[model samples]
Target: MRLTLASYGLLTGIVLVVVVPFLVAVSYRAEQRQPDLSPERIIAASQGAFAPAIPPAEDLAVLELAAEQGIALAQNNLAVILLRTRDSRNHDRADRLLEAAAAQGLVQARYNIAYRIPYRFNTDPALVERQIDLLQRNVAADDIHSMALLAARLGFENRERFVEDRQAEQLALLQNAAATGDPDYLFLHGAELVDRVRNMPPSDHSPARLVVMELALEAFLASFEQGEPRAAQRISAMIAERNVGALTDRLAAMGLPTSDLEWLDMAGQAGLAYADCHYARKVLGDLWPDDLMTEPLYRISAGIVQDALTHPPERRQRALDLAEACATPPQIPEFRPRAFGHTALYLAKHRGGWPAIGDSRGQADVMLGVIAALGVFGPVDREKAAFHFDRAVRVHDYRGGVGFLDRLD
Candidate 1:
């Protein structure tokens, strides 16, 4: 059966209409299953941990295809996946891809490279300027989102330079965002306003300043309560530094079952971040009862004071349990090798700086756990708790800039 020209034409049309769309659909489904190198992925990764909406294997296939197409954004995306994924298999290739995109003047690529540069990439002012410039190119294109970021970086750099006019510039960017109803802009702007009120000289304090302070506090509260952990942490730090009493009252008003002053462990294996806050001791002390603690047990938990009669004991057992359970650092999850590596960090800080617990590690849960374990199992040595505390202080500074990220001032 010899096919005629009409039959060939009909087949070609069929391939274009049916086959092409099918291939495209399959490719799209695959891409959707991986990080699409999209804005959402970038935001999620930068704001929190990298949670690939897609599986890493599937993401790799999509990234590989994007790389093959010579897409600049795709290359950058693939590089980020590779960098974060630590695909040793793709390390060299990912480096090349990033370099290629950076060569093409991709702003995100430049930012990524700048971030990855040695010494926090804060060394050369010129490098930072170049980064700002690349990022600004998009801002000038009316990328409103980029404008907010540019404003933030400019605020930081300008502060270093003592640029007098930056206050207006920062406000202007934020105002634009607010006018457009951008939640991201609101978070940053609200924080800035609060900072302005907080850092003002006492001489400048007035009724108007008080009003502004209230507004700033409200804005921060609004943003924080909406599940913005970074925002909440920032506001909490601000409140912690200033009025722990007031903040605790505010937390109480938020209707938490426990009082605001209590040391509620933040969820997960982060050993003592919750208790380290100033309000923790007071809150924990105010509510916990005394009698149930065994003498030896009573003596061990330093900050602990148990008395059922004097306090609303039943209401605060949850808080006490945290201290009891945290006698050791609980494992978080797979974020480990990093977890124990930081054992050195807690110990070092426990030594030269503020002890993660006290000047001695006896106050630290992990240290306490070690002491308790030794007493029970290994050697029943005297001052073993003190020894753990000392060892914690002597441990290497493993926690590299843990609290510094959201510590924007």
Candidate 2:
């Protein structure tokens, strides 16, 4: 009996000594073959290298692993990849991933989720509320983009039905965002102030409001200096309408550039279509260079004017007529679809006269379609509007879709 028990014990000891060591060796080798990815390397690749193409199978495995391990940036980047790839199922997963990152207080993740809600979530009431909540949270956390978006949305008069004291809160948020020195925020804040002044009754325009308007103009100038082209148009319009001397003095006091010509020159050089038109009309005395086109509309307008200049003296009147038609307003009207439609129709008739100027042609198409659909200048041609709108949307201009929706309601 003792001999039999010893034999069994010896067999157990042999198995432990041999099999256990073999298993441990295999485990160690597996770990050595696949080291954990470093956070820095993953982040860099996700931002640039992995963005242009699909990642290798092994790299995707590593990224998934990192995301599952609660790495917020990894989750956010993976979400971006899924969104780009764009399978319906993957998009839903991407939303979950964005939510996970937002849970970790990632402002960008929150912003992206809010931005996608209308398009991806079909403006679901629940999703819209979630977006508002996310924006509010980010605003409280002092996220600059969040502040700008929230303020802009709230500042619209339509928002008053939803949020109490929307205007005051919107103004405060704009001011907060402007303090960050971001060019976009500066322009938005300045625009909001301008709207406020424009909407107020003349009798109610106090010295305080005028002071705010001056500050807003200064903000616009600052934005222009920071490379915001829209600011140039704003400054040009204000100078053209208001007391230029007083406005210049106010701008100088605020350490902003006071010269309208300098501002126009800068904006024209920066490739703003409106600024180019203004500079050509004011400084060049309607004499546009043959190669002065930057935007498609500019190309059409400038091409017509240039073509007219080449006409014979006897037919110079025809050139002058076309040039007059090509003239853009000194102050761009906010909602002058009639004028825009006229220009658009003229451009459409002479489409072959201008050199093609890339995506600006697409923008012009969209604008013309919207104006025509709204019947702003002439009888509404829904069929023609649908054609242009479809073309614009095919090129990924969702604003065309918005115009369609606006007309629907």
By lDDT, who's the top model here?
2
- Per residue, candidate 2 scores C-alpha lDDT tens digits across 1-409 of 9999999999999989998899999999999987466776565446432334566766677668878988777777667666656379988987898889889987767776876755332345565567677889888887777777676555335555556788898888888988988777788888879888888786674777778778888788778778887777677667666534778777678786676655655665665654544443443133122222222444443544454355444444422222222232234444311100110010000000111233443444444454356453358777766766676556534342334524344
- For each candidate in turn, give its C-alpha RMSD to the true structure in angstroms: 12.9, 14.5
lDDT for each residue of candidate 1 in 64-180, tens digit (9 for 90 to 100)? 666676766667766655554555876677668767877786655654554443323245677656556654575566645545655666655433453357677777766665455
Where does model 2 exceed 4 Å of error? 1-24, 34-38, 49-59, 86-89, 103-105, 119-126, 203-205, 251-261, 281-409
Regions more than 4 Å wrong, model 1: 1-62, 85-114, 117-122, 142-188, 229-279, 284-311, 314-318, 325-327, 333-409
> What shift in Å separates residue 258 of candidate 2 from its native position after superposition?
4.2
TM per candidate: 0.52, 0.60
- Top of the candidates by TM-score: 2
Q: After aligning candidate 1 to the native by TM-score, how far in Å is the CA of 144 from where it should be?
A: 5.9
Go through the candidates in order and give the clash count of each: 12, 0
Q: Would you list the C-alpha lDDT of every candidate in the order shown?
A: 0.47, 0.60
